[model samples]
Target: MSYQDRRSPDPLRRRRRTTPRQRALLELLKRDNHFRSAQQWHAELRTTVGVGLTSVYRILHQFAEQHVVETQRAEDGELLYRLRDTAEHYHNLLCRICGRAERFTLDALEHHTEHVARQYRYADVNHHLDLYGTCPDCAGVAQQE
Candidate 1:
């Protein structure tokens, strides 16, 4: 039998199946909160899910648009992504050693941002902030040695 005929003849059946690439991507992101580049994620996914680099990039972009993932810019300007902990605007306090993250918001910063935007007549202002330190567990481990 030909490839098409050999497979499920029902097109709807195939369409109903979840996109494995997307599912795999979400699972990976959910496992960690560290901001990482698409290539960093793709490297891990490639080993387990065989997802392509381009596909990973595309999926991440879609997640960003949907607000399913938070996006940040790396020091070099490459966009990084992490699974968002909140539906509202937030920032992160990141554990440098373990990559754990705690979500937070600064009302003063938010107000200032808005005030500056209004002063300049800019619309739709947005911001990002991340704080990093060695987490308690990691620090304790170091002390024991």
Candidate 2:
């Protein structure tokens, strides 16, 4: 059978049935732990997979929703995608220059949030923490100036 014929008939409806292009994108993201924009990924994959930009975006969005990929905003405000390593709640220390991420959990912060919520009688509380800064390498580069 042709490669296209083997792809899922309806990617939007079937979560389990992914197109070959989507599978390729997932594999690429899995191999690359660093964050990349949809445009970057599309540019890289076009030469090898012949996938379109819209397909790249659709697949990335679906992966993000399924928790297979994590999304973060760059310094320029463009959304970037990376492979998710775990399902546990955590925060990220992201590098503004190279898009490196260090995941960490703050138990004290969580406790404080819960305490404050209880004091305010709030329910269904959740939080998202993202700390962005230059990494040591980036800082060193800046220092040399």
TM for candidate 2 is 0.78
Tens-place lDDT per residue, model 1, 1-145, is: 0101122233222333448898888888989777788989998888899778999999888876555676765545577788754545666676655455666778998899889999999987776666777777878865445
State the lDDT at 139 in candidate 1: 81
lDDT of each: 0.70, 0.76
Cα RMSD for candidates in order: 11.6, 9.1
- Tens digit per residue, CA lDDT, model 2, 21-104: 987887788678878899988987787798889989998888877666778877677999987655557777889877788877
Residue 76 local lDDT, model 1: 54
Model 1: which residue pairs collide? none
Residue runs of model 2 more than 4 Å from their true location after superposition: 1-15, 139-145
